[model samples]
Target: MWKKKTKQFMSAGSETKQTLHENLAFTAVEQYKLIRANLDFTLPADEKCPVIGITSAMRGEGKSTTAVNLSYVFAEKGSRVLLIDGDLRRPSIAKKLDIDNTHGLTDLLRGKGARIEDFQSKRRDNWYVLPSGAIPPNPSELLGSDRMANVLRQLREMFDYIIIDLPPLNLVSDAISVSPLISGMIVVIREDHTEKKELEKCLRQLQMANVRVLGCVMNGVKTGSASKYARYKYYGNSSRGTGK
Candidate 1:
Protein backbone atom coordinates (compact mmCIF):
# COMPACT_ATOMS: atom_id res chain seq x y z
CA MET A 1 0.00 0.00 0.00
CA TRP A 2 2.75 2.41 1.00
CA LYS A 3 4.78 1.51 -2.05
CA LYS A 4 1.85 2.43 -4.24
CA LYS A 5 1.75 5.85 -2.62
CA THR A 6 5.46 6.42 -3.11
CA LYS A 7 5.31 5.45 -6.76
CA GLN A 8 2.51 7.91 -7.30
CA PHE A 9 4.82 10.72 -6.21
CA MET A 10 8.19 10.09 -7.86
CA SER A 11 9.24 13.07 -9.94
CA ALA A 12 9.89 12.96 -13.70
CA GLY A 13 13.00 10.81 -13.75
CA SER A 14 14.69 7.64 -14.81
CA GLU A 15 13.13 4.44 -13.48
CA THR A 16 16.08 3.81 -11.19
CA LYS A 17 16.12 7.28 -9.53
CA GLN A 18 12.38 7.16 -9.13
CA THR A 19 12.56 3.74 -7.55
CA LEU A 20 15.22 4.84 -5.05
CA HIS A 21 13.35 7.94 -3.82
CA GLU A 22 10.09 6.04 -3.72
CA ASN A 23 11.65 3.63 -1.30
CA LEU A 24 13.10 6.50 0.72
CA ALA A 25 9.78 8.33 0.86
CA PHE A 26 7.90 5.23 2.06
CA THR A 27 10.33 4.41 4.84
CA ALA A 28 8.99 7.42 6.74
CA VAL A 29 5.33 7.02 5.84
CA GLU A 30 4.35 5.60 9.23
CA GLN A 31 6.03 8.45 11.07
CA TYR A 32 4.20 10.87 8.82
CA LYS A 33 0.91 9.20 9.70
CA LEU A 34 1.71 9.59 13.39
CA ILE A 35 2.17 13.33 12.97
CA ARG A 36 -1.06 13.69 11.06
CA ALA A 37 -2.96 11.66 13.69
CA ASN A 38 -1.63 13.91 16.40
CA LEU A 39 -2.80 16.95 14.47
CA ASP A 40 -6.16 15.29 13.91
CA PHE A 41 -6.74 15.44 17.64
CA THR A 42 -5.13 18.83 18.20
CA LEU A 43 -6.53 21.15 15.53
CA PRO A 44 -9.89 22.83 15.99
CA ALA A 45 -12.86 20.94 14.62
CA ASP A 46 -13.58 23.66 12.08
CA GLU A 47 -10.02 23.62 10.82
CA LYS A 48 -10.43 20.68 8.47
CA CYS A 49 -9.35 22.98 5.65
CA PRO A 50 -7.00 21.26 3.23
CA VAL A 51 -4.23 23.80 2.74
CA ILE A 52 -1.54 23.78 5.44
CA GLY A 53 1.78 25.58 5.87
CA ILE A 54 4.76 23.88 7.51
CA THR A 55 7.41 26.14 9.07
CA SER A 56 9.92 26.18 11.86
CA ALA A 57 10.94 28.28 14.86
CA MET A 58 14.50 28.25 13.49
CA ARG A 59 16.51 26.96 10.58
CA GLY A 60 17.54 23.31 10.25
CA GLU A 61 14.58 22.25 12.43
CA GLY A 62 13.23 19.82 9.80
CA LYS A 63 10.27 21.81 8.49
CA SER A 64 11.10 20.76 4.93
CA THR A 65 11.29 17.13 5.95
CA THR A 66 7.97 17.33 7.75
CA ALA A 67 6.27 19.03 4.80
CA VAL A 68 7.60 16.58 2.21
CA ASN A 69 6.87 13.46 4.23
CA LEU A 70 3.44 14.67 5.35
CA SER A 71 2.35 15.31 1.79
CA TYR A 72 3.68 11.89 0.70
CA VAL A 73 1.82 10.10 3.47
CA PHE A 74 -1.39 12.01 2.87
CA ALA A 75 -1.17 11.09 -0.81
CA GLU A 76 -0.55 7.48 0.19
CA LYS A 77 -3.86 7.60 2.01
CA GLY A 78 -5.39 8.61 -1.33
CA SER A 79 -5.55 12.38 -1.00
CA ARG A 80 -4.87 14.44 -4.11
CA VAL A 81 -1.99 16.38 -2.64
CA LEU A 82 -0.25 19.45 -4.05
CA LEU A 83 2.93 20.31 -2.16
CA ILE A 84 4.33 23.82 -2.68
CA ASP A 85 7.80 25.00 -1.90
CA GLY A 86 6.91 28.45 -0.63
CA ASP A 87 10.31 29.15 0.85
CA LEU A 88 11.49 31.28 -2.04
CA ARG A 89 14.69 32.57 -0.50
CA ARG A 90 16.05 29.15 0.42
CA PRO A 91 13.97 26.51 -1.28
CA SER A 92 14.72 22.93 -0.21
CA ILE A 93 11.73 20.92 -1.41
CA ALA A 94 13.21 20.41 -4.89
CA LYS A 95 16.38 18.84 -3.54
CA LYS A 96 14.51 16.83 -0.96
CA LEU A 97 12.04 15.49 -3.52
CA ASP A 98 14.74 15.24 -6.24
CA ILE A 99 12.86 17.73 -8.43
CA ASP A 100 13.82 21.04 -10.00
CA ASN A 101 13.37 24.42 -8.34
CA THR A 102 13.68 26.36 -11.56
CA HIS A 103 9.95 26.96 -12.11
CA GLY A 104 8.07 26.94 -8.81
CA LEU A 105 6.02 29.39 -6.72
CA THR A 106 8.20 32.37 -7.54
CA ASP A 107 7.90 31.87 -11.27
CA LEU A 108 4.21 31.27 -11.01
CA LEU A 109 3.74 34.40 -8.91
CA ARG A 110 5.78 36.80 -11.03
CA GLY A 111 3.65 36.37 -14.14
CA LYS A 112 6.96 35.89 -15.89
CA GLY A 113 6.24 32.36 -17.12
CA ALA A 114 3.72 29.49 -17.07
CA ARG A 115 0.34 28.44 -15.73
CA ILE A 116 0.10 26.77 -12.33
CA GLU A 117 -0.51 23.36 -13.87
CA ASP A 118 2.44 23.83 -16.19
CA PHE A 119 4.76 24.33 -13.21
CA GLN A 120 3.63 21.32 -11.23
CA SER A 121 6.02 18.34 -10.85
CA LYS A 122 4.16 15.07 -10.46
CA ARG A 123 5.24 12.37 -8.01
CA ARG A 124 4.08 8.87 -7.10
CA ASP A 125 0.46 8.36 -6.06
CA ASN A 126 -1.70 11.49 -6.24
CA TRP A 127 1.12 13.68 -4.99
CA TYR A 128 2.44 16.73 -6.87
CA VAL A 129 5.10 19.30 -5.98
CA LEU A 130 5.48 22.94 -7.02
CA PRO A 131 9.10 23.92 -6.53
CA SER A 132 10.17 27.42 -5.42
CA GLY A 133 11.44 28.37 -8.89
CA ALA A 134 14.01 31.16 -9.15
CA ILE A 135 14.99 32.88 -5.92
CA PRO A 136 13.63 36.35 -6.33
CA PRO A 137 15.29 39.35 -4.77
CA ASN A 138 12.02 40.30 -3.12
CA PRO A 139 10.50 37.06 -1.94
CA SER A 140 8.36 38.52 0.82
CA GLU A 141 6.81 40.98 -1.55
CA LEU A 142 6.14 38.23 -4.06
CA LEU A 143 4.52 36.01 -1.47
CA GLY A 144 2.27 38.83 -0.30
CA SER A 145 1.23 39.73 -3.81
CA ASP A 146 -2.24 39.09 -5.14
CA ARG A 147 -0.81 36.65 -7.66
CA MET A 148 0.20 34.24 -4.92
CA ALA A 149 -3.31 34.29 -3.47
CA ASN A 150 -4.79 33.66 -6.87
CA VAL A 151 -2.48 30.73 -7.47
CA LEU A 152 -3.40 29.25 -4.11
CA ARG A 153 -7.12 29.62 -4.83
CA GLN A 154 -6.69 27.85 -8.15
CA LEU A 155 -4.74 25.04 -6.49
CA ARG A 156 -7.39 24.61 -3.80
CA GLU A 157 -9.87 23.78 -6.51
CA MET A 158 -7.57 21.27 -8.18
CA PHE A 159 -6.19 19.45 -5.12
CA ASP A 160 -7.68 17.69 -2.14
CA TYR A 161 -4.82 19.04 -0.01
CA ILE A 162 -2.10 21.67 -0.46
CA ILE A 163 0.97 21.49 1.74
CA ILE A 164 3.38 24.44 1.74
CA ASP A 165 6.93 24.42 3.03
CA LEU A 166 7.92 27.83 4.38
CA PRO A 167 10.96 29.49 5.83
CA PRO A 168 11.32 29.73 9.58
CA LEU A 169 9.21 32.53 11.07
CA ASN A 170 12.20 33.89 12.96
CA LEU A 171 14.24 34.17 9.79
CA VAL A 172 11.85 35.79 7.36
CA SER A 173 8.47 37.44 6.95
CA ASP A 174 7.61 35.05 4.11
CA ALA A 175 5.58 32.79 6.37
CA ILE A 176 3.53 35.66 7.78
CA SER A 177 2.81 37.09 4.37
CA VAL A 178 1.42 33.75 3.20
CA SER A 179 -0.21 32.75 6.49
CA PRO A 180 -3.61 34.20 5.67
CA LEU A 181 -3.64 32.12 2.50
CA ILE A 182 -3.21 28.80 4.33
CA SER A 183 -5.70 27.02 6.54
CA GLY A 184 -3.23 26.55 9.37
CA MET A 185 0.48 26.43 10.19
CA ILE A 186 2.78 23.71 11.53
CA VAL A 187 5.89 24.81 13.41
CA VAL A 188 8.72 22.30 13.41
CA ILE A 189 11.22 22.39 16.24
CA ARG A 190 14.03 19.95 16.89
CA GLU A 191 13.92 18.37 20.34
CA ASP A 192 16.41 19.71 22.89
CA HIS A 193 17.64 22.12 20.23
CA THR A 194 15.07 24.91 20.02
CA GLU A 195 15.34 27.45 22.76
CA LYS A 196 12.20 27.93 24.84
CA LYS A 197 12.57 31.69 24.63
CA GLU A 198 12.88 31.55 20.85
CA LEU A 199 9.80 29.38 20.63
CA GLU A 200 7.88 31.87 22.74
CA LYS A 201 8.96 34.72 20.48
CA CYS A 202 7.96 32.79 17.39
CA LEU A 203 4.53 32.20 18.87
CA ARG A 204 4.25 35.89 19.63
CA GLN A 205 5.11 36.72 16.04
CA LEU A 206 2.45 34.35 14.77
CA GLN A 207 -0.07 35.81 17.16
CA MET A 208 0.77 39.30 16.01
CA ALA A 209 0.21 38.19 12.44
CA ASN A 210 -3.05 36.50 13.51
CA VAL A 211 -1.96 33.21 11.97
CA ARG A 212 -3.46 29.97 13.22
CA VAL A 213 -0.65 27.75 14.43
CA LEU A 214 -2.03 24.27 13.91
CA GLY A 215 0.71 22.51 15.86
CA CYS A 216 4.42 21.90 16.37
CA VAL A 217 6.46 18.93 15.17
CA MET A 218 9.21 18.02 17.60
CA ASN A 219 11.95 16.73 15.30
CA GLY A 220 14.90 14.60 16.37
CA VAL A 221 12.88 13.38 19.30
CA LYS A 222 14.08 10.08 20.67
CA THR A 223 11.75 7.23 19.89
CA GLY A 224 11.04 4.12 21.98
CA SER A 225 12.69 4.35 25.35
CA ALA A 226 11.82 3.98 29.03
CA SER A 227 11.57 7.76 29.20
CA LYS A 228 9.72 8.16 25.90
CA TYR A 229 6.34 8.12 27.63
CA ALA A 230 7.52 10.74 30.08
CA ARG A 231 8.64 13.04 27.26
CA TYR A 232 5.38 12.56 25.44
CA LYS A 233 3.39 13.55 28.49
CA TYR A 234 5.54 16.60 29.04
CA TYR A 235 5.10 17.85 25.47
CA GLY A 236 1.47 16.85 25.25
CA ASN A 237 0.62 18.76 28.43
CA SER A 238 2.59 21.78 27.40
CA SER A 239 1.01 21.89 23.96
CA ARG A 240 -2.57 21.16 24.97
CA GLY A 241 -5.20 23.78 24.03
CA THR A 242 -2.32 25.57 22.32
CA GLY A 243 -0.96 24.98 18.84
CA LYS A 244 2.49 24.00 20.29
Candidate 2:
Protein backbone atom coordinates (compact mmCIF):
# COMPACT_ATOMS: atom_id res chain seq x y z
CA MET A 1 0.00 0.00 0.00
CA TRP A 2 2.83 2.40 0.82
CA LYS A 3 4.42 1.74 -2.55
CA LYS A 4 1.17 2.48 -4.35
CA LYS A 5 0.67 5.87 -2.70
CA THR A 6 4.22 6.98 -3.38
CA LYS A 7 3.67 6.42 -7.09
CA GLN A 8 0.52 8.50 -7.05
CA PHE A 9 2.27 11.46 -5.44
CA MET A 10 5.15 11.35 -7.89
CA SER A 11 2.95 11.22 -10.97
CA ALA A 12 3.53 14.27 -13.14
CA GLY A 13 0.00 15.45 -13.72
CA SER A 14 -1.33 18.99 -13.44
CA GLU A 15 0.91 19.31 -10.34
CA THR A 16 4.68 19.79 -10.14
CA LYS A 17 5.26 16.66 -7.95
CA GLN A 18 6.86 18.51 -5.02
CA THR A 19 4.45 17.70 -2.21
CA LEU A 20 6.08 14.33 -1.58
CA HIS A 21 8.64 15.88 0.71
CA GLU A 22 6.62 14.96 3.77
CA ASN A 23 5.92 11.38 2.78
CA LEU A 24 8.93 10.00 0.92
CA ALA A 25 12.60 10.52 0.27
CA PHE A 26 13.08 8.65 -3.03
CA THR A 27 10.97 11.21 -4.90
CA ALA A 28 13.34 14.13 -4.36
CA VAL A 29 15.41 13.34 -7.43
CA GLU A 30 12.39 13.46 -9.74
CA GLN A 31 11.22 16.71 -8.17
CA TYR A 32 14.71 18.23 -8.52
CA LYS A 33 14.84 17.30 -12.20
CA LEU A 34 11.48 18.91 -12.75
CA ILE A 35 12.65 22.08 -11.04
CA ARG A 36 15.90 22.39 -13.00
CA ALA A 37 14.34 21.62 -16.39
CA ASN A 38 11.51 24.03 -15.61
CA LEU A 39 13.88 26.91 -14.89
CA ASP A 40 15.96 26.32 -18.00
CA PHE A 41 12.95 26.42 -20.29
CA THR A 42 11.07 29.31 -18.67
CA LEU A 43 13.85 31.67 -17.58
CA PRO A 44 15.64 33.88 -20.09
CA ALA A 45 19.41 34.29 -20.01
CA ASP A 46 20.40 34.86 -16.36
CA GLU A 47 22.47 37.91 -17.29
CA LYS A 48 19.57 39.45 -19.20
CA CYS A 49 16.92 38.86 -16.55
CA PRO A 50 18.09 38.08 -13.05
CA VAL A 51 15.13 39.05 -10.93
CA ILE A 52 11.90 37.06 -11.05
CA GLY A 53 8.79 36.61 -8.94
CA ILE A 54 6.85 33.46 -8.06
CA THR A 55 3.22 34.19 -7.35
CA SER A 56 -0.19 32.52 -7.38
CA ALA A 57 -3.86 33.23 -8.08
CA MET A 58 -4.85 32.52 -4.48
CA ARG A 59 -3.17 31.45 -1.23
CA GLY A 60 -2.12 27.88 -0.24
CA GLU A 61 -1.28 26.88 -3.80
CA GLY A 62 2.43 26.12 -3.32
CA LYS A 63 3.93 29.38 -4.66
CA SER A 64 6.39 29.59 -1.78
CA THR A 65 7.41 25.98 -2.20
CA THR A 66 8.00 26.56 -5.90
CA ALA A 67 10.21 29.56 -5.23
CA VAL A 68 12.31 27.72 -2.64
CA ASN A 69 12.81 24.59 -4.72
CA LEU A 70 13.56 26.55 -7.86
CA SER A 71 16.15 28.58 -6.00
CA TYR A 72 17.73 25.39 -4.65
CA VAL A 73 17.95 23.92 -8.13
CA PHE A 74 19.36 27.14 -9.62
CA ALA A 75 22.04 27.19 -6.93
CA GLU A 76 22.78 23.53 -7.58
CA LYS A 77 23.72 24.58 -11.12
CA GLY A 78 26.53 26.67 -9.56
CA SER A 79 24.71 30.01 -9.93
CA ARG A 80 24.68 32.41 -7.01
CA VAL A 81 20.95 32.55 -6.18
CA LEU A 82 18.98 34.55 -3.63
CA LEU A 83 15.50 33.51 -2.51
CA ILE A 84 13.55 36.29 -0.88
CA ASP A 85 10.29 35.76 0.95
CA GLY A 86 8.45 38.79 -0.45
CA ASP A 87 5.13 37.69 1.02
CA LEU A 88 5.58 39.86 4.05
CA ARG A 89 2.03 39.51 5.24
CA ARG A 90 2.44 35.74 5.52
CA PRO A 91 6.06 34.89 4.96
CA SER A 92 6.87 31.15 4.78
CA ILE A 93 10.28 30.83 3.13
CA ALA A 94 12.16 31.39 6.36
CA LYS A 95 10.23 28.67 8.15
CA LYS A 96 10.51 26.38 5.16
CA LEU A 97 14.27 26.82 4.92
CA ASP A 98 14.64 26.56 8.72
CA ILE A 99 16.53 29.88 8.91
CA ASP A 100 16.25 32.73 11.37
CA ASN A 101 13.85 35.51 10.39
CA THR A 102 15.44 38.03 12.72
CA HIS A 103 15.96 40.60 9.96
CA GLY A 104 15.15 40.70 6.24
CA LEU A 105 13.74 42.84 3.41
CA THR A 106 11.41 44.80 5.63
CA ASP A 107 14.19 45.62 8.06
CA LEU A 108 16.42 46.58 5.18
CA LEU A 109 13.76 48.88 3.69
CA ARG A 110 12.94 50.72 6.90
CA GLY A 111 16.52 52.05 7.22
CA LYS A 112 17.13 49.89 10.26
CA GLY A 113 20.77 49.29 9.38
CA ALA A 114 19.65 46.24 7.44
CA ARG A 115 21.65 46.50 4.26
CA ILE A 116 21.29 44.04 1.38
CA GLU A 117 24.64 42.52 2.28
CA ASP A 118 23.43 41.98 5.84
CA PHE A 119 20.15 40.21 5.05
CA GLN A 120 21.68 37.26 3.26
CA SER A 121 21.68 33.90 5.10
CA LYS A 122 24.10 31.56 3.40
CA ARG A 123 22.45 28.15 3.47
CA ARG A 124 24.14 25.34 1.58
CA ASP A 125 26.25 25.38 -1.55
CA ASN A 126 25.43 28.59 -3.46
CA TRP A 127 21.93 29.18 -2.05
CA TYR A 128 21.05 32.12 0.18
CA VAL A 129 17.83 33.26 1.88
CA LEU A 130 16.29 36.62 2.75
CA PRO A 131 13.34 36.23 5.04
CA SER A 132 10.56 38.82 5.16
CA GLY A 133 11.55 40.13 8.55
CA ALA A 134 8.77 41.03 11.03
CA ILE A 135 5.46 40.86 9.16
CA PRO A 136 4.11 44.30 8.49
CA PRO A 137 0.46 45.31 8.37
CA ASN A 138 1.20 47.67 5.49
CA PRO A 139 3.13 45.44 3.12
CA SER A 140 1.85 46.96 -0.12
CA GLU A 141 3.08 50.46 0.58
CA LEU A 142 6.39 49.23 1.92
CA LEU A 143 7.03 47.08 -1.13
CA GLY A 144 6.27 50.08 -3.32
CA SER A 145 8.78 52.23 -1.47
CA ASP A 146 11.80 53.49 -3.40
CA ARG A 147 14.09 51.78 -0.93
CA MET A 148 12.81 48.35 -1.95
CA ALA A 149 13.52 49.04 -5.60
CA ASN A 150 17.07 50.13 -4.84
CA VAL A 151 17.66 47.01 -2.80
CA LEU A 152 16.46 44.88 -5.67
CA ARG A 153 18.85 46.68 -8.02
CA GLN A 154 21.74 46.03 -5.64
CA LEU A 155 20.71 42.37 -5.40
CA ARG A 156 20.54 42.09 -9.18
CA GLU A 157 24.17 43.11 -9.37
CA MET A 158 25.18 40.48 -6.81
CA PHE A 159 23.24 37.31 -7.49
CA ASP A 160 22.83 35.42 -10.73
CA TYR A 161 19.13 35.04 -9.97
CA ILE A 162 16.78 36.61 -7.44
CA ILE A 163 13.56 34.64 -6.95
CA ILE A 164 10.92 36.46 -4.94
CA ASP A 165 8.08 34.48 -3.38
CA LEU A 166 5.05 36.72 -3.22
CA PRO A 167 1.52 36.62 -1.86
CA PRO A 168 -1.59 35.72 -3.77
CA LEU A 169 -2.47 38.27 -6.45
CA ASN A 170 -6.16 38.10 -5.49
CA LEU A 171 -5.64 38.83 -1.81
CA VAL A 172 -3.24 41.79 -1.69
CA SER A 173 -1.69 44.57 -3.78
CA ASP A 174 1.83 43.82 -2.55
CA ALA A 175 2.71 41.39 -5.35
CA ILE A 176 1.50 43.80 -8.01
CA SER A 177 3.45 46.66 -6.49
CA VAL A 178 6.68 44.63 -6.41
CA SER A 179 6.18 43.22 -9.92
CA PRO A 180 7.60 46.21 -11.71
CA LEU A 181 11.00 45.71 -10.09
CA ILE A 182 11.37 42.14 -11.26
CA SER A 183 12.14 40.73 -14.70
CA GLY A 184 9.10 38.43 -14.87
CA MET A 185 6.49 36.53 -12.82
CA ILE A 186 5.29 32.94 -12.70
CA VAL A 187 1.81 32.09 -11.45
CA VAL A 188 1.19 28.80 -9.67
CA ILE A 189 -2.25 27.19 -9.96
CA ARG A 190 -3.47 24.05 -8.24
CA GLU A 191 -5.18 21.30 -10.17
CA ASP A 192 -8.99 21.36 -9.86
CA HIS A 193 -8.63 24.22 -7.41
CA THR A 194 -7.88 27.29 -9.49
CA GLU A 195 -11.10 28.18 -11.28
CA LYS A 196 -11.14 29.69 -14.75
CA LYS A 197 -12.59 32.93 -13.44
CA GLU A 198 -9.90 33.22 -10.78
CA LEU A 199 -7.16 32.68 -13.36
CA GLU A 200 -8.66 35.33 -15.64
CA LYS A 201 -8.89 37.70 -12.70
CA CYS A 202 -5.24 37.08 -11.85
CA LEU A 203 -4.19 37.74 -15.44
CA ARG A 204 -6.18 40.95 -15.42
CA GLN A 205 -4.49 42.02 -12.19
CA LEU A 206 -1.03 41.46 -13.67
CA GLN A 207 -2.02 43.25 -16.86
CA MET A 208 -3.33 46.21 -14.91
CA ALA A 209 -0.13 46.29 -12.87
CA ASN A 210 1.99 45.92 -16.05
CA VAL A 211 3.64 42.74 -14.74
CA ARG A 212 4.74 40.32 -17.41
CA VAL A 213 3.70 36.75 -16.50
CA LEU A 214 6.22 34.38 -17.95
CA GLY A 215 3.97 31.32 -17.63
CA CYS A 216 1.54 29.40 -15.44
CA VAL A 217 2.55 26.36 -13.36
CA MET A 218 0.10 23.55 -12.63
CA ASN A 219 0.77 22.10 -9.18
CA GLY A 220 -0.34 18.79 -7.52
CA VAL A 221 -0.21 16.57 -10.57
CA LYS A 222 -0.41 12.78 -11.01
CA THR A 223 1.42 10.84 -13.69
CA GLY A 224 1.84 7.12 -14.47
CA SER A 225 0.09 4.43 -12.39
CA ALA A 226 3.27 3.25 -10.76
CA SER A 227 5.32 3.68 -7.62
CA LYS A 228 7.28 6.89 -7.19
CA TYR A 229 10.55 4.95 -7.07
CA ALA A 230 9.59 1.98 -9.20
CA ARG A 231 6.71 0.53 -11.23
CA TYR A 232 3.70 -0.71 -9.32
CA LYS A 233 1.59 -3.81 -10.04
CA TYR A 234 -1.75 -2.04 -9.86
CA TYR A 235 -2.20 -1.19 -13.55
CA GLY A 236 -0.12 -3.85 -15.30
CA ASN A 237 -2.11 -6.88 -14.08
CA SER A 238 -5.33 -7.67 -15.95
CA SER A 239 -7.01 -8.54 -12.62
CA ARG A 240 -7.32 -4.82 -11.92
CA GLY A 241 -8.98 -2.17 -14.07
CA THR A 242 -6.58 -0.85 -16.68
CA GLY A 243 -6.32 2.92 -17.03
CA LYS A 244 -8.06 3.79 -20.30
Kindly list the per-residue Cα lDDT of model 1 for residues 78-141, writing each as its tens digit: 8778888888888877666555566767766777766655534445547777888889898888
Question: Clashing residue pairs in candidate 1, if any?
Answer: 7-124, 8-123, 8-124, 8-125, 9-123, 9-124, 9-125, 10-123, 10-124, 104-133
In order, the Cα lDDT scores of the candidates are 0.70, 0.68
Off by over 4 Å in 2: 1-35, 46-49, 115-123, 225-244
lDDT: which candidate is best?
1
Per-residue alpha-carbon lDDT of candidate 2 for residues 1-244, written as tens digits (9 for 90 to 100): 1111112223423243434233333454455445455555555543453687888889897788778766766776788888899999888765665556778888778878766555444444466678898888889988878888988877777788889999999988888988878877878877668878888999899988888766666665554535442210111111122211
